[model samples]
Target: MKLYPIESGNFKLDGGAMFGVVPKTIWNRTNPADANNQIDMAARCLLIEDGKKLILIDTGMGNKQSDKFFGYYAMWGDHSIDKSLAKYGFNRDDITDVFLTHLHFDHVGGAIQWNKDRTGYETAFKNAHFWTNDNHWEWATQPNAREKASFLTENIMPMQESGQLKFIERPQGDFKENSELGFGILFADGHTEKQMLPHLKFMGKTFVYMADLLPTAGHIPLPYVMGYDTRPLLTIDEKAKFLNAAADNNYHLILGHDAHNEIITVQHTEKGVRLKDVLTWSDVLTGY
Candidate 1:
């Protein structure tokens, strides 16, 4: 199996929201904010090439929203899912499965796009089966007040409407091993209900797609949770358990939102689990 890190684009978000209760004095040292107090974040996606399957994890925010709607996020950069796919000598039609970690706009917006006539939306990946869990599908479709804004209808409903949406049976416990995608599914609730983090076994090693569960290496600290998380206290416990296992097993973390840093391995430190090494995509392909 081959894995490619797809660069979708970058956007700005309030550093305070990204760092949760962690004070600026602390988080700023790691992720400095701009004059407007927003930190840069990448909508990096992952592409998996295995035999007859080409699965994409997350599609980044698409370019369908109005300028006024996008003005709030302060998006920048020329990278996009289409351009990134072309870089690998592929196209949207080449994807067979789209595994969404969650339904947040930044993560799933590109799953659908405006049709040629501009009359309505259509599945962006025409040949793909969109995968999400039953619990998250319900949670996202019937979003609570706090998360409603992030779960836009245009970014979601079209997949189901297009008859391409499929739900993974909610796992009874922590994860389901070697499911359809040939990986373990780690369910995280602190960030959002039943958010699935793929535990992929590739190149004879384990690589966990660290969605919002661990947005960046800077978020390795247990206390550095995101304010956007519906349950911050629960996030602390989740991070502690996941980080410990990640450190013990030496699993490489594939960061989804970190703009500058790519892959990282964590180690148990005196303070807590800390980044052991920052790795590049090439380093992953070449080994160690």
Candidate 2:
């Protein structure tokens, strides 16, 4: 199996919102903010070439939203989903599966795109089976007040409408119990209900997609939770548990929104699981 780091693009978000109650003095050290107090974050996605299946982990925010809507996020950078795929000698049509970590606009926006004539939406990856959980589908489709803005119908409805949407097996227990994914799926509720974090076993190393659960290395500390998370206290508990397990097992965590750090490992320290080592995707995947 081969893995490719597909950078969708970059966008700006309020640093305070991204780091929750964590003081600016702390998070700003790593993710320095602009004059407007917005931090630049990468909408990084992953592509997996496994046998006959070409699976893409999260699609970045597509260029379909109106200028007024996009004015809020301040999208930047030249790395687009198409350019990244072409860099790896592939195209959207080559993707066989689109495994969405969640239905948030930034994560799944690139999953659908405007049609040729711009009449309506269509599946971005025409050949891929867009994967999302049944429960998440319902939650996103009928979103609550706090999350309604993040779950855009334009980005989601088209996948199902195109007949390319499929749900991974979900059982009685936590979603992970029933997740016999090619890699593995770690269900995290602190950020959003049943956000799927893909764990990949590659090159004798475990590479985990640290979705919004751990957006960046700066969030390694238990208390550096995102204000957007519905359950902040629960996030604390979840982070502690996951960080410990990640440290103990020496897993390589791939950050979802980190613009710099790609992969890192944690070690047990006096303060907690502090970052032990940092490496790039090439280093871990191809030993470059």
Candidate 3:
């Protein structure tokens, strides 16, 4: 199996919101903020190539939003999914599966695109089956007031409308090992209800896709949870548990929103789980 990092684009978000109640004095050290107090973020997606199935994890924010919407997010950079795919000699049509960690706009926006005539929306990966779990599907479709803004209908809806949406059947436990995808699935409710983090066995190592649960290496500490999470207290507990497991098993974490760093590993320290090493996708490839 081969894994590729696809950078969809870069955007800026309020550092305060990203780091939650964590003081700016602390998080700013790792993710320095701009003059506007915003920090750089990436809509980095992962592509998994195995056999004839080309699976893409998390489509970054697509370019379909209006200028006003883009203005709010401070979207920047020339990187795009098309160019990134071309870099690997592939295209959107080659993707057979789109595994969404969650339905937030930044994570799932690129899953759907505007049709040729601009009349309506269509699945971005025409040949792909958009994969998300039943619980998250409902949570996003009928979003609560707090998360309603992040779950844009334009970014979703079209996948199901196109008859290409496939919901992953939740097995009879809190976590289910998906043999078909060659990964184990862990459900995290702290960030959002039933956010599926994939524990992929690749290159003789275990790699966990740390969606919003652990947005960046700076969030390695238990208290550095995002303010956007509905349940901050629950996030603390969830993070601690995940970090302990990661440190004990030496799991490499694939970050979704970290603009500068692609992968990281943690170690148990006196203060708690702390960043052990920061690595690029190339480092993993070369090691393999």
Candidate 4:
């Protein structure tokens, strides 16, 4: 199996919101903020070429939202799913499965796009079967007011409407070994209800897709939860348990939202589990 890091695009988000109650004085040292207080963010997706199936982890926020709508999140960079796919001599049509970690716009927006005439929305990966768990599918479709804006109908309903949506059997416990998608899944709820963090076995090692569970390395600290999360206290506990296991097993974290830091490996530190190393995509392909 071959794994590729697909660069969907980059944008900026409020550092304050990204790091929750963690004061800027602290987080700014790690993730510097701009004059307007926004920090660089990347919607990096992962592509898995395993035999006949070409599975894409997340699609990133696509370029379909209106300029006015996108104005909120200051976007940057020329990277797109098309360009990234082309870099690997592939295209959207080649994707057979789209495994969404969650239904947040940044994670699943690129799964659907405008039709040829721009009349309505349609599946971005025409040949792909979009995957989300039953619990998350229900949580996203019937979103609470707090997360409604992030779960846009245009970015979501089209997949189901197009008859391409599928649900994984929600695991009875926090971790499931070798899910239907052929990888272990670590379920996290502090960030959002039933956010599935894929535990992929790559390079003969464990690589966990750090979705909202650990947005960036800056959030490695237990208390630095996101303001958008509905359950901050729960997030702290969830993060502690996950981080401990990640450190114990030497799991490589593939970050989804960090613009600068790509891959991270944590180790036990005096303070707590801290960043052991930051690796670039090239570093990942070549060696440790």
Looking at model 4, report the run of 10 residues with the lowest lDDT sum: 176-185
Tell me model 1's lDDT, rounded to 2 decimals.
Answer: 0.92
Query: Which residue pairs in candidate 1 have backbone atoms (N, alpha carbon, C) closer than 3 angstroms, thus clashing?
Result: none
* Candidate 4 per-residue C-alpha lDDT over 1-288 given as tens digits, one digit per residue, 9 for 90 to 100: 788999999999999999888899999999999999999999999998988889999999998999997899898999999999999999999999999999999999999999999999999999999988889889999999999999999999999999999988776789887545788888888878999888888888899899898999899999889998888999999999999999999899999999999899999999999999899878888885
The runs of at least 3 residues in candidate 4 whose Cα sits more than 4 Å from the true structure, single-residue gaps closed, are none
Best by lDDT: 1
Give the Cα lDDT of each candidate. 0.92, 0.89, 0.90, 0.91
Q: What is the number of backbone collisions in each predicted candidate, taken in the order shown?
A: 0, 0, 0, 0
Query: By lDDT, highest first, what's the ranking?
Result: 1, 4, 3, 2
* Cα-based lDDT at residue 175, candidate 4: 88
TM-score of each: 0.98, 0.96, 0.97, 0.98
> RMSD per prediction, one decimal?
0.9, 1.5, 1.1, 1.0
Could you tell me which 10 consecutive residues in candidate 1 have the lowest summed lDDT?
Answer: 170-179
User: Ten residues in a row with the worst lDDT in model 3?
Assistant: 173-182
lDDT of 4: 0.91
Q: Give the Cα error of residue 45 in candidate 2, in Å.
A: 0.1
Candidate 2 collision pairs: none
Residues 172-282, candidate 3: write the lDDT tens digits.
866898866777888889889899998888888999888999998788888888999988899898888889999999999999889999999999999888999889988
Task: Estimate the lDDT of model 2.
Answer: 0.89
Candidate 3, residue 22: Cα displacement in angstroms equals 1.2
